[model samples]
Target: MPWFQLVANGDATDPNDYNAVGGPSCSGPNHICAIQASPNTNNKPIITTPLRNEMITALNTNSSSTNVQLRTNP
Candidate 1:
């Protein structure tokens, strides 16, 4: 089945919080938003195409699947 996998570290899966579309991702509520981008300590908020494109390029994966990559300011 298609499922959301939370990669907490490199090639590692999160202990909890796995959903089809990464549901229950936010602790605030079970509510889903129509917004495309939401920045945070856990999730990577996407806004610009260049940024999105660069991320995809970095993924370096060859699959017709949706992937999400998160990073923090260092």
Candidate 2:
């Protein structure tokens, strides 16, 4: 298995270098997951949002739009 890191930026609110409070550090969880409740976070408007998804998809050779698919499926 591969490893990942969440370097802190001296901010305590953001995800610690180990996913303590928030995640990967950022302005905030001001996206859908924390607001709209759309369940469409796979493409969250944040960087780390799509980063992990894409990485996993690349390693598994799967489409990264799984959320999009779920939205269109019956």
Candidate 3:
């Protein structure tokens, strides 16, 4: 399987209020989006990409207010 990061708005208590790292907007009662992880030649997850890192950093910074979590789908 791949990995995904969940970004929840507000309290994160509602399952429909979250979205994937690189997915579409979490509108209505949509299911969890899947943002595939970037793996290296060794099949290991890598987050060195500038865009990914930027997104993660933004999420972390916003975590103080919202709920941002890093989850892996193994």
Best by lDDT: 3
Which tens-of-lDDT digit does each residue in 1-74 have in candidate 2? 11222233432113222222222222322221111112223322233555445444433542223321111111
TM-score per prediction, in order, is 0.23, 0.21, 0.27
What is the alpha-carbon lDDT for the whole of candidate 1?
0.33
Ranking by TM-score: 3, 1, 2
Cα RMSD (Å) between model 3 and the true structure? 11.2
Candidate 3 has its poorest 10 consecutive residues by lDDT at 63-72
Model 3 clash pairs are: none
Candidate-wise lDDT, in order: 0.33, 0.27, 0.38
lDDT of 1 by residue, 1-74 (tens): 12243333322222233323543232221121112233434554433465345445534542222233333222
Look at candidate 3 and tell me the lDDT of residue 28. 30
**Cα deviation of 60 in candidate 1 (Å)?**
1.5
Stretches of model 2 off by over 4 angstroms after superposition: 1-47, 62-74
Model 2 pairs in collision: 15-22
